[model samples]
Target: MKRRSLILPVMLFALLALVPLLATLGPRSFILAITTRIVILALAALSLDLLIGYGAMISFGHAAFLGLGAYSVAILSSHGINNAFAHIGCALAVSLVFALITGAISLRTKGVYFIMITLAFGQMLFFLGTSLAAYGGDDGLTLAQRSLVFGAPVLKNDVTLYYVCFAALLGAYLLCRAIVASRFGRVLRGIRDNPVRMQAIGFAPFRYQLTAYVLAGMIAAVAGVLLANQAEFVSPAYATWQRSGELIFVVVLGGLGSLHGAIIGAAAFSLLAELLSHYTEHWAMIFGPILILVVLFVRGGLTGLLGGGR
Candidate 1:
């Protein structure tokens, strides 16, 4: 809410917006491509922060929505329906319905039970995706073409798609900032910090938490749509528990409870992985310890170090 609080995210987006231009100075397409992936994944991580950070709901299966969205695009594209609007609509619809059903059942539990239930649901989706033999099944499916905008394959252009994804990340960030600062956000946080107290004051914690869950799922689905386009493929792997863990890591690595921290964390994680992989195939061994150090020492993550852990 403060001007100082806005500075980091604004500057981050500004830098990201310039990346396509910056790419021209070097590896060009490769740099632009990786940057686009980071921005898309950042959007997914930002959505998770809405639940885990502000709402205190740890969903271990959130990536299911991402897989659903990506599959929506992949399936639709395979059927010769390349419309962007259709892909987005189907993605959001499937994720919204799935989140509503799963969140309803999962919200009945608390703490670890809630986490396990979400993970179970996520795995269910993962298996379902695997069983879709019509859509390439466990091997995954490739899109013959990216979604078209007004019959134009605008998203097929790397630079154009990069900018589009950049705008999406920026837009998602602003929308989340608004949500976390709104009356609804207040109710969500109240439920997060003290659910019993909130209920005593006439706020139904289940309703608010479920709403936040569905909202977060829908946002993640948006990221999935972008990711499917970015990769031109959809796989069960996208919805795996491991992918969910990475989203959690991104949120934590950037510091919990801060929206922009999600973006920073995503960038840091992506770049770190890219950098580490160049030296060793088993980069996770080294990357794992760095994450541990961040958890033990960083406290609030990079945002905390930068004094923006709000």
Candidate 2:
């Protein structure tokens, strides 16, 4: 009973911490813009956290879903299909099918073998995206128009787009929280913590892992759609292995198992990139070292740096 009272305080603290950031930046400033990007990337990171932190699945091909989702919108819009629903529906379905097929096979292996299989699949997907001659082929496709949300221009305004992304980020956060606490989440957690024990209790580890993988893929696809919308372009670079590494970086940065940490990590990573890039062309060289330092000393990430409230 006493422990339950801690929740409100934690929530209030997190909200309060944001006040400083918000107060210091204008709506049109780079901070806010980067923050929105953080939210978008966080959605992808959150999905990876489910597979890695909770399910113990090391997926190196996760960005394939992102690429698939991005391409779905780009390809459809190229043919004059601009409805948001149509693009999103096709993206989700395709990503789910891909996840189901890949997860089924990848879940059969473990450790380095699982890692290699997923990496191989991701590379296959990357090359596949690079082969679409109709959509810029090796150069990638540029989105001529953004999807129309029910015929209304919900995403035409930068502020509106940011809010839409924020809402999606909020929804993703809530959904993840609910999922992590639900019965299915418990089983997945059980499998992660003790696969042998879960199987001993008649629970099939592969089945749960695969289900989680598919769900993660679907969510990751949603992120892909938002990301392409955010960037206003689709490219093979979307499916790069380096992007997958960044997703894993967020999972670890936010402290494994803390869903909201994904958001914080994304904001940190993106904002850092933006700020650093403003200084020089060799920004990534600097970013790499910083990431290494974080992994070495920080351990839990920004949320942890903030006392692990949310």
Candidate 3:
């Protein structure tokens, strides 16, 4: 219970940190860039936590949703449909379609099989993206300009874009928190703890799982759209298995099922990567082992290590 108290403080710290990032730093654009990436990834981490922690669905192919979102924005904007709402709608629609159809099949299995099937489907999308030679085959498609909001360029200002991503992160976290506390969430949690018992109670586990899957996919698409806007680009790399792994790692590192934990984990993970890469060219060589050890020794991930508060 005491661990739960850490949630508020951690969130406050992350929020407050942005002030200095936006203010004190010279050429603060770089810092804003870092903050934007962290916020966007934080949203993605929140989406992953919803299904994995609450719904007990482990998917290694989640990055496919990110690709879908990125492409939705890039492709539309490429053809001059630059409205933010249009791109956002396209992203969510594409992600929902894929998640629903795939969840129906993948949720039929359990555990390792579920993971494998999701990974396969995700690869299918990755390859499909690679084949889009017109947009950008092995390479990525770059947006000619930032997306239009109403009429002006809402995403043109780097700082404004950072705040937009931050707001989305906050919204996703709140949405996930509400979901986890709802009547539906209680059933989903029960399904995770004991699907057999949930079935005994006459609940259809697959329906709940699929619902959560689609919701998660939508959330991921939100992150993906923000990512495309930030980079002003979209690529097949967005759907790579390694990218999916990093997302899963974010959830586990944060302490599964804890919304605050996911945010903390994402911030820490992104900041660590940014910092470590600056000090060394082969940062992954050092970072990977550290993560391996954390997974090995700190079974609770960040929350477990910190004795996670609320």
Candidate 4:
């Protein structure tokens, strides 16, 4: 990548690293809490960017993986499996299976059919979650405590948790950056633009696209693990269509195709929503127009506004 491309992500991470210090100036807990949520969601958004931006697979059921990750943590913790490694392992395994199966079926279709199938799969998971009465079902489940780190309550400290999540976000960003620059990423993008042409050159577009889909799902599941730890709760609402839509909005708001744009977009969307909700309960009404204006006028979302072309 060019030095110019590194500039924005570097600055973004530097500011994020300073956030705990900045929290001392204001509502410390509130600042740490909200920013942590932003980081986690940004991770999720980043994964979606891998699909939508590069793979051109508009997955409407993306939040299903998020919900799956959160539930993995919640359900395991409830069963006395509080180990962080176990939670992560279970989440990844579940997400991998779900993504592989769904991607195989979804990739066989195109355009609106693909979108609707993803949506259908997401709703199927949502209803399944609500049916899990043993895990609180529609009511949601609260964690007894955060996942243990080698039998220690290391993540219980707010600041420690914040840095852990920040590190995960940074790591996920780097992983995605590497993937996008790799030969596999190139094949995926080629498939996105012209699958037939790619096939003519001996590349199986289905396999590449399906692999990318599975990878994106697994990454988003990790975010879901962090989210469960952050919120200390899990609910079926996490997999709802509305939540999936918001992830798409976050990607578009940040500028599609650019990994760093997802981070900037998540920050903008979360912070803007936080600011708006305090003044009015009807914030979505006002926020809707703002997003519409950006979609209509802004060429590439907030990242574009910052002079970073997608």
lDDT winner among the candidates?
Answer: 4
lDDT assessment of candidate 4: 0.94
Give the per-residue lDDT digits (tens) of candidate 2, residues 1-310. 1455346435733663463357365654555556657777888998998888889998988899899889988999899888889989999999999999988999889999999999988988998888888888888888887788987767876666677776676677678778877999999999999989999989988888898999999999988988888788999899989888889877777667777677767767887888899999899899888878877887576666666554
Off by over 4 Å in 2: 1-32
Off by over 4 Å in 3: 1-10, 13-17, 20-23
Q: Residue 288, candidate 2: how far off, in angstroms?
A: 2.6
- Residue 284 lDDT in model 1? 98
- The ten-residue window of minimal lDDT in model 2 covers 1-10
lDDT of 4 by residue, 1-310 (tens): 7788778889999999999999999999999999999999999999999999999999999999999999999999999999999999999999999999999999999999999999999999999999999999999999999999999999998999999999988998999888888999989888889989999999988899899999999999999999999999999999999999999999999999999889999999999999999999999998899999988998888888897655
Candidates by lDDT, descending order: 4, 1, 3, 2
What TM-score would each prediction reach against the true structure?
A: 0.99, 0.90, 0.94, 0.99
- RMSD (Å) per prediction: 0.8, 3.0, 2.0, 0.8
State the displacement of the C-alpha of residue 145, model 2, in Å, after optimal TM-score superposition: 1.4
Report lDDT per candidate: 0.93, 0.81, 0.86, 0.94
lDDT of 3: 0.86
